[model samples]
Target: MQKILCFTALFASLVLTFLNTQSEAAIGANEIIRFSWRANTEPVTGYKLYYAEGAVTGPPFNGKNALQGNSPINVGNVTQTSLSGLDVHQNYSFALTAFNECSESAFTDVIIVYSVTISIHGNGTVGTYTSFWTENHGNETIHFFPSDGHFVSNVVVNGTSFGSTESITLNDVTEKKVIDVYFSPEKTVERDTSFPLWSGSFNENADVQGSIFIASDGVYVSQTTDTYTTNISKVSDGFCPKSGWNANYHLIQFIDVDNDGWLDIAGFGYNGLVVAYGIDGTNYHTAVNVISGNFGYNNGWRIDHHIREISDIDGDGVNDVWGFGYNGLVVAYGIDGTNYHKPKLALNSFGYNDGWEITDYRRFLDVDNDGYLDISGWKDGVNYVSLFNSANETYDNIVEWW
Candidate 1:
């Protein structure tokens, strides 16, 4: 019986020793911190790592507090063996538990990691005489010149850098003066190019309310008011469809249609005569049969709509007659030596409200230099000009006159 009792005590001691050893060998605090543990006898199917800022202590830890406990927030589930997002420049506490149907391992050692954010700015300028630099994103530099085309200096922007040499010559300017700044990651680089992105000029003496006519030779100019002497004569035979013996038209120009240097007078009339008088020194000699059997007629009426005086409609060398009739129809006719070509109709639609009567039509001028000539006129108390591109045949709604 004594021997049996001794054996029983030994067996109990051995079992207790084995249990203690297993518990001791369970995931160590250091191993947990490094996430270096493999599947143990307990079969760690997953893991739960808990971390908090500040120091930790004790086995079944108690009385231990987190530095950032007041703002405790979950960093979220991560499958990786190691994790991050701990407060930089500060200590942190951590623990790991092998999660499965059975039980978890021990707590882990504390760790610390560091992190930060930053920003930067830069700029510069260039020109003949004056130069400046700025951190401001203005990114544009302006160099001005006096009327004599002399460079004006003394330019500066606050909180900026200007190179050592200050003086520059105005004669170094291009026809279309412009300086461009190229931006780099660290500094702004300036480059001067020949073409100016934007350019314009204002003429104080420009004739706005006038007729712009292009002659057969393609010379264009505006005639503001009548510069003619009217010589009225009664016609005994009725020449026009409408019964009127008082038909007369005024001469508006003398164009050298053949470019022979000598000018010819072009006359306007109301069912009367369109005589071309050749210049003979100071006096003029009438050209014979210059109007016989010609379809040219003044129509005996004037409509206040915008009239398109004669010009090259098809871009052909010869000048074609273009005008807006009283009925709001745009008419174009080719002019030969004896007769006029059939009128090509444009914008002809019945009951189509034009909003305002046609006032005039003129050759396109690309005011914006967008390579399109814009037509300008008055409509409904507003004068507007639309731009048309000859190359693309596209029209832009940029009106400007009124």
Candidate 2:
């Protein structure tokens, strides 16, 4: 025998805003909705929250008609509870009930609503006049504003290139969306379509075969034809997926790692991770994590470390990564196709620490005219050279240059 736990009063309302306009304002799919009510006058063990798809009208608002298998969840003896991970594509009706060991109370009035989440990326922000979470299908005006000295370059919605405008009104939003707003400097508001596009610290300055690859802030890469007049910018998802590669303090190097005549991008993250992006014709794809970490050399390799040089350390005709920084720390690895072999500890330390900081003087060349590339640099006012032995793959012959 089950007895109905009677409550003096029960109320349920959306934590955000309850809009009753011509167009129902829904909630964001990724948002958490909290429901709170007045405590029952009688003694009760706890409360259970039940939700089902579609607007449940009339009758008992109970878990029997809930969408998911795990409908009514026991939220313990609390007057308030929060729930998240709701599907925005569907309408939902929520019902609450109080229960004791022997009896359960009748569910409260049903609350029907809908939801969807919007994400923003790049150098601008998004502003929706209403709450990201809404109810009825209605037009949403999303405003995009750029930072100082920057203008909206492109507005990409769900990967489709939308017009570059100050704002975009999404007519009748019904699903999850991602908005990427790329910004360009005010000076370059109008694109440069001249011959021999300007190359500086911003774009790629490498020659891939007869063509040159250009990069915009490391986020985009464009390729130029032999004539240097026609510039084609292509966006691919193969550039530095992991390793936290940023353009602020990171260094980018373009080289033919596979020796297939096509130049690839090898970016060194500030945290000692190497990310490589291969180029095919005008597109850059197949991003691979070349070096996971510094391999226990130094914590990080900054821009001044000069570790972006790609050379053949063992003279295998294949380019390798040679990096040196403060504390005489060195990190070297030989490239094998898109992957790299075990790191070759060419030189761990050069006697004194903090020596490489005296000057930006470091080189990975055949200093003594050896077949293999040697390491030569200044360590605390003293010039030293470490000759590489190709046979054993080590740097042994250490000498001082007075």
Candidate 3:
């Protein structure tokens, strides 16, 4: 009969420590992490090391998973050994085990060797200007904001030029990196027009050349002949007979309200607004109030408020109405059929009373091509995008664009 004998190899603990004053002479430019552990109480032949790059949730560790080098690294019977050829930018998880001629003991608790440093040298800042370190495979966005009269000349990433983009995102970071931003004095360049400018009769091409004008009583469209003779026709009464329409302070724009492939008239007056569909250049339906009551001049809406053309601000495919108040109040209404849905306050008060002229410098578009439209503008020496929630501070996501 063969006798079956059982022996146990138990490890009290396994520890990982970073060697402070260790020299990397044999490993060239690679780094080292020193590991120490209490030897098993029972006699064992040797210890094997197992490791991987990322966090190991709970593991029945395998030796072939080592990232830097081979795992189950035979460290003989030593209780401590220094691992070399490690990349400092990578996070590592390690476990230890003891093996004998009969069987190997269970793996010890996982020990993590994870942390990397990021060095930033620039005139601007990123993410609140704090946090100099990030976990492996983390993400971060860098925003460039040059001082007044200065512009970002170039953004250097690990000694490579990253173009003149206002912002950039570092995705899945896996290396120790250096970012340097340089600035230069702002300069203006003058250039002539790319195409020649000319004037001719508006009726030369009947379908292409026409002008729409507004009067105190109604709206009109005009066409001019070769002899400079102008002829006009009344288009719609959506503006004159319209409720709360202001003769001196009103505006109108051509828009396709119902998606019917026909042009419509959207009128904005002193106290009220309307969207009149079925405009065929000569007649249109009676203007219906898009908004219930008048937006008083002193309250939220006014004659000078910027009323933008219909756009899919919410990315719903259907065009919506957008209005920017002079006091930096932004209002948008989603469209349902020919009626505007409930109003949503996109921005409460950003740059309140700051004399922002959206018609001249501000535009709403997808500056980052993220599908949703963003409030973008240029003022003074800076070009800015309100990418996120822009409450009252207008300096968010701002960059110098010459």
Q: Candidate 1 lDDT, tens digit per residue, 66-122?
A: 332222222223233443232222334444444444444454443221111101111
How high is the lDDT of residue 390 in model 2?
72
lDDT score for candidate 1 against the true structure: 0.31
Candidate 1: lDDT of 134? Answer: 13
Report the number of the highest-TM-score candidate. 2
Q: Write the per-residue lDDT of candidate 3 for residues 1-402, one digit (tens) a residue.
A: 444334654555887665423211122233556778988887777888887765674464443423345776878898998776655445567888887778778878777554332333334433322122223435656566666765554456666454344556776544445566654445332211221111221222222234444454555443322211134444565465333455345555666666654556676655445777743333457777775443333235655545445656665667776666654534445567476765545664333365566444767767767565677777775676666433552223434444
Q: What overall lDDT goes with each candidate model?
A: 0.31, 0.53, 0.54
Write the candidate numbers in order of decreasing lDDT.
3, 2, 1
- Can you tell me which runs of candidate 1 are displaced by over 4 Å? 1-260, 270-273, 277-308, 313-317, 327-340, 348-364, 367-374, 380-383, 386-402
Ranking by TM-score: 2, 3, 1
Best by lDDT: 3
Q: How accurate is candidate 3 locally (lDDT)?
A: 0.54
lDDT (10s digit) by residue, model 2, range 258-348 = 6655556665654444544444433456455666666222445566443456666566777666665444535555656566765544576
Candidate 1, residue 301: Cα displacement in angstroms equals 4.1
Worst 10 residues of 3 by lDDT: 189-198
